[model samples]
Target: MTNPLKKYGDARKERIDQLAAMSDGSVAVADAGTIEEAPGVSLIASAWRRLRRNPVFLTGLTITTLFIFLAVFARVIAPHDPAIGYLLDKVRPQSNPIPGPEPGFPLGADNVGRDFFSRLIVGSQQTLIVGVFATLFGLTGGLILGILAGATSGWVDSLVMRAVDVMLSIPSLLLALSISALAPRPSQWTLIIAIATVQVPVFARLLRGTMLQQRSSDHVLAARALGIKRSSIVFRHMVPNALGPVIVQATIVLATSIIDAAALSFLGLGNPDDRQPEWGQMLGQAQQFIYDDPHLAFYPAACIIIVALGFTLMGESLREALDPKSRR
Candidate 1:
């Protein structure tokens, strides 16, 4: 008996070869000037070309770059040891524990007399770690669930979607708060886990929605007709096309993760060690002396706001740039 599948593949391959030969012959015969079209730019390259010209993107890029630089070089940037608080005895007074600017300390000291300037610089490190790791965790989990749901159309999709729906039902903040509160200890890892868990549903839904759209796309149908492996069709053809929105969402989620980490720290569920300074921890401590030393809260709050704004602006600019129909 003739192998039907093999015959079908061979027939398709022959047709493709003939088409390639015809295209080659046509190009050879055509005049150079007849091909008026410019060379095509890839999607990523085009998006980057657009982003380079956008001022909003440049501003956001600058802020985000500065923030990352501060985080990475905090040890070298901070003059004093954040944990030791050398200025403690010098800055502390009986009447007013936290003192204003002194010789060694430019921003003065925290409520506990730790060098506020040094602490603020180090705070960037903690914030970056938490925000980045949490967002990564969420993105990873979401990708897994999205792939599962998108690649298969049956009970598997329903099961994954149901689970995602369950997660989405709960308020994100509340879910994070609950998880943080339930942790055995208040630490950086705990905060990251809580925030990441809350973020999973958002990422999963976005990817899945895009994935479903890709499932019925013409390219996908053609890929199937070409007898490509199921895995290749899902990852190479479908997932890559579906990732644009998810990538934009991930950038915005970075800002949210930082805010959530700060909120958790502010609520006293964050790391208890003063040795490791965090903006939220600073705010929580400053709350006691907010009326007398409002600057304590002001500085850290400003850092948080600026960082969040930078990520949001960058994400928005990226989305606009990546959009095919955008005027830009």
Candidate 2:
């Protein structure tokens, strides 16, 4: 019947094919350099290049990298056996003994004669372990509690927020001390749990406020209008978008977590085994000898300070980098 509609469809198809062919030819002629200028690749590459240019970020990154490496390779890097005490050279300060010294003494020795250097290295392991686990536990607990509270307002939100407020009112150190004392000995699991509990309320309040702000955004309204499941929208869309601040906060929390764990260990509420050469234990055992061989306390204390500062700097750098207002 020589239909007009059939002819129009065939003409459109031919035009599309011609356009596609022209596009392919253009692409081929543009060369590899042109193709490499794709938006996603250039954006990531530019960000990486910019990151390399920032001196503060680079310095923080280097310090953080070294600590992470040491934390991972503590056992292998440690020179002297952490557990073994060099009793023959006990309480020897930084001052070297006679020229032909017996067994070459290190920065003195701890109360039990453990190598202070070795103990410091080993302590990194416990500090890293507790910090990572406790931060994860607290972050997860906070996210869940926050979502539940914010997603459903009214009495549920009030109750959850008030509970967080109560937790926040108590001093973190005291709360940790009471909890550690009441609970079983500070095994890895117990310490992790204790630190997590103490830190969770802070994260909860932070996340709840962020989530509440997000809940009223246009995208959230659109999602609701489109009949998207509330759970999927909150967990997938909302949470991911609001994660920038949370991630920055988490890093700072990690630093604080390490300090808290060390404090607990120093107070003797940490790991049960006395043989384990934790930093805090070394410092605690060095109390009497502070005057005799200050290095005994100072060495471990210095290690803690350095590691904590590294984390703090990294967190600050990350927050600065991620925040648009901060950049301006």
Candidate 3:
């Protein structure tokens, strides 16, 4: 009897050839406009087209760009020195005071009479820095671990996955807090590392799962059958294909990292200097006079919320765009 599997494969190949021939005939009869619109549209290009039309994506992109600009030009744009405060004003009686939105101080002054607007402008730099670096650290670590686990099998995969599981078992905030506690002093780098440590297992697990799915796909199997090096097959074929979810996750993680960093700072695990104009530290200080000057708390809290919202909107939009079901 003829081999069943070989016969099935031959039949499948013949069917594919017939489909190709049909497609060619259809293309030949198609209008020029239809052909032009169909051929050049790649996955990324199609996604971009979809994103451009999405109002949520546009809003997020605008807000994110504005924050980035504010972070970059903080020093040039800030009206006054953020560190200096009006001690003279602080010395005055509590009943009589210089109120907010005063001349030269658009957003008014903090409890110590520091320019609230300037502090907010400068604070964006520190907040963005922490979010960005922490995300980078986490993404880098996760990519390495995910690739190692997904590309291998048996003991190697088990070992890496077990470590990921252990990390995941811990509450993220608690894990970050524990790590930050180990630092001798509250520092920016310490906060970044702590947040990043919490984030690694998340990204690693996501990428590893995606890679596992991709590895058994026809393209990966073909590459392996072609005698491609294992490293090339994994990196060149597997990683790139699995990166869509990772990129989307990175944006969401960035927002979380910023919030986590702010929480760390609020808990007094930030810079030792009270004068530093980080948003979380500012909020920490404002809590003492919350009833007295709610705006002090409001401004920083608003900034944090707006920034995080921007990242979240963008991440969600990207997720929708990348989803195959959404395309259909």
The number of the candidate with the highest lDDT is 1
Residues 1-328 of candidate 3 have per-residue lDDT tens digits of 9999999999997887777677856643224346344556788888999999999999999999999999999999999989888433653446634346767878777666778888899999999999999999999999999998988889999999999999999999899999999999879999999999999999989999999999899999999889999999888889999999999999999999989999999998877676667888888888877877788888899999999999999999999898887663
Tens digits of per-residue lDDT for model 2 on 1-328?
Answer: 7989999999987887776677746554325356354445543354456667777667767877888899899999987777787653543445532112135445444555556666778778877888899999999998888777877899999999999999999999898888888875567677778889988898888888888888999999999999999998998777877777788889888889988988888888888786666777667777876775677778788878877787787777777667666752
**Candidate 3 ranges with C-alpha deviation above 4 Å:** 1-37, 86-90, 93-99
Roughly what TM-score does model 1 have, to 2 decimal places? 0.87
Q: List the residue pairs that clash in candidate 2.
A: 85-113
- Residue pairs clashing in model 1 are none
lDDT agreement of model 2 with the native: 0.77
Give the range of the ten consecutive residues with the poorest summed lDDT in model 1.
Answer: 24-33
Per-candidate TM-scores read 0.87, 0.79, 0.86
Model 2 TM-score, all chains together: 0.79
lDDT of 3 at 264: 91
Listed per candidate, the RMSD to the true structure in angstroms reads: 12.1, 9.2, 9.1
Would you list the rank order by lDDT, best first?
A: 1, 3, 2
In model 1, the runs with Cα more than 4 Å from the true position are: 1-36, 91-93, 325-327
Model 1: per-residue Cα lDDT over 98-181, one tens digit each: 878979889888766788999999999999999999999999999998888888989998999999999889988889999998
